[model samples]
Target: MNEDAQAALGILAQQIRMAGNNPDQPNRVGNANPALSSLRNPVYGTTSLTLAGTNTTSQLSMRGCDGTFTNINSTNTTTTGIDALTCVAGGTNTVPDSIAVSYEADRFNTIPTGGTSSLPTDCLGNKLPVVTATVSTIVAGTASSADVTYTVADNRYYIGTASVANVVTPSLYCKGNGGASVQMPMVENIETLQLRYGTVSTASTATTATVAGYLHATEVLTETSMALLANDAERWAKVATVRICVLVRSENPVAPNAASAQYTDCAGNLVDNPPDLRLRRAYTTTVVLRNRRL
Candidate 1:
């Protein structure tokens, strides 16, 4: 392939990677993409450790959602210990084993009660609106009532500091200086993009959550719909995954052929007789929210 063609393919790859692998910030509650809004909450799961065998003197460790482990020493009985058996420190004693350790999603960081006087901004200086009922808690596990400070935004897997934004409303087509209509490329060669959301219903009992169905971005992108989604904790809690699809084309045109090629779009619609000679391809990816799963 020529350098230009290689460069075009590289751009397409980069865009797909960005949309697929970019993990949501722990604090970011939902998808902020202007063109496509979907669930972006991190999945909530549990990490447990059991204290068994003849090892009373061994210190027990607790791993947080952020992957950091904290040593639970015998002295930390009142705070981190579970029952009468204290997590011992620096000794080797046998029997009287405490063989049970449970992790429940009891801690949450929410927007301060009664709203904040000042606006909140992320680390990237992007302004954040006052989010009501923006609670980040663990689901599926037994909950603890105690409010503990936990890590929310682990910058490790995050892509851009600011939320993804696009100017979809404004048309890029405008009149040129020569009084001729021309298309100005705001984002080069990206033709279409679509997003689908998968939501689960709140479990009535301790059973596993089930995904209701996939909905297009337009179905849930309205103001009223967004409000309903935000206020309904059960609905928000049910968001399990998001599917992203991006369609891109080469800047240069290919050899024109009499027969047209058919392509399958993101919505599973067949596009017959696609008349463009520019080499085009669609990329798709699915992201699961670990914190939302059981």
Candidate 2:
């Protein structure tokens, strides 16, 4: 080959090596691209793990989902009681034992306006104004023992119950009911989810509290996270109180090299580290509690 042609081949080989792409090697293992396989369920997020070995029989211990377990049998390519999730394999099938937690929902709809559909007034009617049975009109404050006299802004007048059970702060996706059902896909392959309860002071500060039965890093979210958050959210909404905020964090550390190789030191010097991972997109929502009793 001519010198120019040889030099061109050398550059091409270098580029191929950088990409980890091998064309001629036989039985190569590392050249395959990594892949993400997910399982889906009606309960909220992905919840199951399955893999296939060269053998016809394979078993995977299902974890997560309110701390439950089942064995997956791949020999038949069928799973027992594992729903809403599918096992996928590709890219030399180099699957990681752990995956980053991912929560995704379809496009969100704008909060509705007008009448009770609006905020301050919960959509669940947990805060419907109560009418007093007293002879004269009376206004009840948070401390007032007697029922408060109030007129309904709308046609419906609901009787006063002790309080309404708050549903979990619903992560509502525009299901295209206005059009089509929005698809919500979630995965918890990371360390798990951690929920921190904070008190919203008049100063607008969120003071974190160590709440028992709260979310933790080691806990796979499944239904528990959704359940606990809903309970706290209901209590928060029923009281007719100040705006409250909940802090949600993924226990899963951002994968190393998940971000770009660039880093800024304490002094703001940019340094490049080529061996870093990039951060992937994730989903989480914060619900605010407003409307307080005076």
Candidate 3:
């Protein structure tokens, strides 16, 4: 090759080495994926996914372990670190589940609606918390009225039946706050929902007013217990992201023919059928809590 071309190649090689092999920007150090070392540059862009259909494009991006990003859509998502004990069976070896709940048309009726409604029971069902220490399946059928409540706090988990309950389950989880009501257990509130990052593995309510660190309202993981993981970062090294999703239902499910269907208020009125529930376009990301020397 000519000297000019050779020089250009040499310069590019140096840049790659200095910036790391990845086309993406610098990662949050500890969270950088060595496997993705060559693929860098994560930004908002639309690619012609289709051959000749329409010059359409979709938004794509990546996030650091200790970072957060928002998508083209207005959904707000968070990615942070949680305790290791909250992971599923695979623990750090796998991608933790993700749950995204968006405001959809009320399930109680057709067309747009108003007011909050209860979620569908057995939707994803209630999964158990991380009891095995190696991550376990979120126990389904874990939400019982006698064992849970939402009247006081956002993330509260009680035990037994609402009518004749007493002792609370140590592993129960609950921290929910929609616009109107908080759906506990397995209530499918709206028309449709989406799952991103992973799945809707578990959802538990808190018993009293407790500050959930890495836990999301829809699912539970070890990272949710931030202080616990912070104290034992070595044990909780598998977690990469802690995301939060909110499934807000309108106060009342309105009929499709409602005159105020087109209204757009805090209660979120709509004129047509809402789209399926997708992961919030935004999220807060955190790194795997590990002791770093000062």
Candidate 4:
């Protein structure tokens, strides 16, 4: 269970670190172009994912960086978080026990035609398409090819969870060239999954260099909450880290009079005597946004 939780965290954290700048704010940090991209809320936190009497659940969606991106496809019709190309989970689209979310990522390979890995791939080592288009630019009376030919395609990941028999499993949706979402079941017996955004408040949303401290997504100052210069999108850009916490159940039941009914949850709250008799453990990770920090 611990291993499974850790593995899931790694996958989520890696994408968070590679998150691109929100395209809504023109003066946001990161070199990603705001024109081609319509991302405003790089890290968009949707409503809580409530399971059957489960406490640990939250829906989070983010935009993957392109330095060079677009709105992803969704089954929902809600326009919430449109700036960031995010949609709230609703309209019979499943929630709590299960939900659908689009995981932002770059589907193309940018190896400049020569790299150790002979093929492009998704999160799993599956073969994928590569960018083969190039642009010609002349500088100093010399013509040079901007070899971005290897950086074209973008992937749309549609993530969700499912319950089979009695065990619940979380799956990762990998989008392919033909625009097909492949469902990859990640781990099993995951009881709860929660995520909290780490954001910083600045005097002006237009600029942010060093973050003082990370605050809760709601606690963070915004023009709507504090009437400060800090806007919604800018505050999201100030997010430097993401905290992921997951709880998994043991496969086999504990021996008689051996298992502890109480366990600590991802929120640091003491969950006294859970309903089930199976052993459970919580795993957590705080991932740094490498692209944002840089």
TM-score for each predicted model, relative to the true structure: 0.35, 0.18, 0.18, 0.57
The 0-to-1 C-alpha lDDT of every candidate, in the order given, reads 0.31, 0.21, 0.22, 0.44
lDDT of 2 by residue, 1-294 (tens): 123223322322222112111122122122132111111111111122221222111111111111111122122212221221233222111111111111111112122335644421111222322222211122342222222122111110001112125512111110011111122212121211212222222222233322223222123222343335333222221211111111112223355553443444212345465232422222222222221111
lDDT for 84 (candidate 1):
30
> Residue 45 error for model 4, in Å?
21
Residue 129, candidate 2: alpha-carbon lDDT: 27
What lDDT tens digits, residue by residue, belong to model 4 across residues 231-294?
5445555666666666776766673543376778766777776766777777888887665622
Q: Which stretches of candidate 2 lie over 4 Å from their true place?
A: 1-180, 184-195, 199-234, 238-276, 280-288, 292-294
Scored against the true structure, residue 263 in model 4 reaches a CA lDDT of: 78
Candidate 4 clash pair list: 20-65, 23-39
Off by over 4 Å in 3: 1-236, 255-294
Candidates 2 and 4 compared: the better one by TM-score is 4
What is candidate 3's lDDT per residue for 1-294, written digit by digit as tens? 123223322322221122111122222212253322212221112121111221111121111121111121121111111111122233221222222211111232112123364432211222211101111112353421111111101111111112215622111112222222333332212211111222111231222312224433223223343334333322122222323222223323443543433333111333243332221111122222111111
Q: Against the true structure, whose TM-score is highest? A: 4
TM-score of 1: 0.35
Compute the lDDT of residue 160 as modeled in candidate 2: 13
Put the candidates in lDDT order, highest first: 4, 1, 3, 2
Question: Distance (Å) between predicted and true CA of 86, model 1?
Answer: 52
What is the lDDT for 110 in model 2?
20
